[model samples]
Target chain A: MIEFSNWDILRNLLLAAQWTLLLSIAAFIGGTVVALTLTAMRLTRNVVVMRIVRVYVELFQGTPLLMQMFLCFFGLSMIGYEISAWGAAILSLTLFTSAFLVEIWRGCIDTLPKGQWEASRVLGLNFLQTLRHVILPQATKVAFAPTVGFSVQVVKGTALASVIGFVELTKAGTMLNNATFEPFKVFAFVALIYFALCYPLSLCSKYLEKKYHVAR
Target chain B: MSLVKLDQVHKYYGDFHVLKGIDLNIKVGEVVSIIGKSGSGKSTLLRCINGLEAYQQGGIAVDDKEVTSEDIQVRRLALSVGMIFQSFNLFPHLTVGENIMLAPTIVLKKSKQEAEKTARAMLEKVGLGDKFDRYPEKLSGGQQQRVAIARALAMNPKVLLCDEITSALDPELVGDVLKVLEQLAAEGMTLILVTHEMNFARDVGDRVVFMHQGKVWEEGNSKKLLSEPQTEELKQFIGAVL
Candidate 1:
């Protein structure tokens, strides 16, 4: 039987926290860019482009994040395309984040009145110019609250990456729990850390939601 | 030469005809007011001019260029034909100045500084000089509509298409906006207004177009149309209003 000290457990958990932070940032940035591309593609009149983006959105959204992680981490390895767990986790999270983000942002763009588009067109703006000068500037204000709120979900989602042997907070907690047989304390600490990170974001999101009234 | 000409202009919404075989012409600097009952294609006719609503069968020309094309001419047509709306439809995210400045900066290729100067000049013309930095929501409904008018004017349009510009305004607010339009018309800005205010229409319009059932019911001088409406529909319309 092996015993790990509290100091060792805490150190390992802190180290894992770095990867969690990294993964969240990577996923968010990657998702945002991809989500914007998807949003534009979905809005296009081109049938082929719209269908391809629709399929991409469906594939990512329909599958659970856990299944996506499994496919990226294990399924790829099974086919002899070996990749790091960090890479796998990030890939899965990016896909998951992008799908949800595209839908969320699309909803914001959708809420803008058809009159706004007509108004911009009448002002002599072509498609790109209309989006830049008129539509997006307004839609972005409409998008802000939900987008900030969605970040909390992204933070919580990072925990799932631990299942794929990624050394994040959850994986560290599990290891500590196994050694000390103190599931309650170890898990409680892990939950508290997550709450510490996520609750503020949740509160910030709530504050913005109240401030912006995006739904209203 | 006619500034705008629409020949056999037809528009449909899934077989619900919004505009039916419409034909109209106006020379440069003429002010034409299209008056109609709600859903009688006054707005639709204005929208079709700028290619905002594509007509199924029509040859619509703005400054002698056909709007139904993939060329820069359609974009060029938009540049010439500016349409205002029933709702002010100012970009809520932009300041009054930005709202006016945006088209010039993006579409007309004016530098930001140059565009801002033009925007400020237009806002001043609309009696909103002190409100350059004010957001749309910060302004009153009448003020917002004025900014929308100023925004259209900033494009330096060859023809200004107004769709019920004063319809959503309160009675008191209506006069001020109409005053601005009268001034624009006086300055020879080639105005086409879709309005419900009969007095403003008669006073400011050079020509009056009465629309009914997606067609132009009557067309004549504003004095003739208002004083002695010839058609039964026009007489009934004037009677109902009076």
Candidate 2:
């Protein structure tokens, strides 16, 4: 077995964490765009569009993130289009993140008093205008805390990308363990890095919750 | 021709009839007070005039234009008819000035400078001139309702529909809002209000309408209607509230 120094394990894990961070950012941004569209569709009051968005949300949320990663990495190749592990991980993670973000945002929208919509409508603002000027500005205040809290989930979710050979932190930890035969040491370091990455977000989310909760 | 007219208007909420075959007319610059018990459809009739709630049958006309469900037309009607609610419904995120400026800027396509100028003027008119920078949640209930009136007036509407605008105010605060309404009536702004304040109705209103079970049970000169009720429903309504 190869001898692995502490610094070496730390350096490799840190390097792998960069990919995890990149994946998390990509998934978050991509998911937000999709989620915004889905949320708008749900708000349209069109039964067909609402049902389609509901099915999309449920399909992603109902299954494990692990299964989604497998399908994206392996299932797409069988259909004819070959996708890289990086591509598959981002696609699956983005869809997974979007499903949850849509629901979170919809709840925020619903929390607004019905009067806000009526008031804006009677003020001569159209649906989109009402949403942009009146409804969304208020809803965002309510949404900030939960949205940031969910980012921690997104950060941790990057770990599942390892199963698809994306070479993120967890995958790097497993490779290091195999070479050095140090399971406990490698995983403990992995857990420490994840905690480091996620703790500040958790704190920020709580801070936002406390600050904006009064507005609700 | 009347500035506002409702002809045989009927409205329903799934099998529950809210407004049933109502006919009313208001001349320009007249203040009409609608008084009734809860579930009497007084508010529904006022709401119908602004197209805030759709009437299933009959028609409503404001400034000679029919109020329809068409989006563009409804928006155009909004320019002519402004509404105030009991809850104020001021955009909580916006400062008082911004709330007043929003419709003028967005719907009227006025320049920001012009809208703000009008907003400040409307605030002054409503006695909230110092509250231009404050948020709705930061103000007293009466101040907030006055801000709502200012917000509605900034649009330069021909008529203002006030639905129980003072119902949510504290007793001490209610007078401030009613004072603003009285001032609006004195200025000859066409005003239609659904209210429980019988004394204000008698003093400020040119006509008092008593709505019962979704119909106008009685209506006449404010003093005549309140002092002498023609129907049992009106007498009991006046008795219970007074």
lDDT (0 to 1) per candidate? 0.86, 0.92
**Residue by residue across A1-216, what tens digits does model 1's lDDT show?**
777776777777778787878889999998999899899888776899988888998999898899999999999999999988999998999899999999998898889888787777777778888787778877887777788788878888999998989988899899888888988878877887788888887788778777777433
Q: Interface RMSD (C-alpha) of each candidate?
A: 1.8, 0.9
Candidate 1 residue lDDT tens string, B1-242: 89999898999989899999899999888889899888999988887887777789878988877887452555778778888899888887888888898888888899999999998899999999999998888888899999999999898889998888887888889888998999998998898888888998898889999999999889989988899888899889988987
How displaced is residue B81 in candidate 2, in Å? 0.5
| Least accurate 10 contiguous residues by lDDT in model 2 chain A | A1-10
Q: What would the per-residue lDDT of candidate 2 be over residues B42-161, giving only the tens digit for each residue?
A: 988887888777889998999999998766777888889899999999998899999999999999899999999999999999898899998888999999999999999998989999
Among these predicted structures, which one has the highest lDDT?
2
Candidate 2 lDDT, tens digit per residue, A84-179?
A: 999999999999999999999999999998999888878899988999999999899999999999999999999999998999999999999998
Give the DockQ-based CAPRI class for model 1.
medium
TM-score of chain A of 1: 0.92
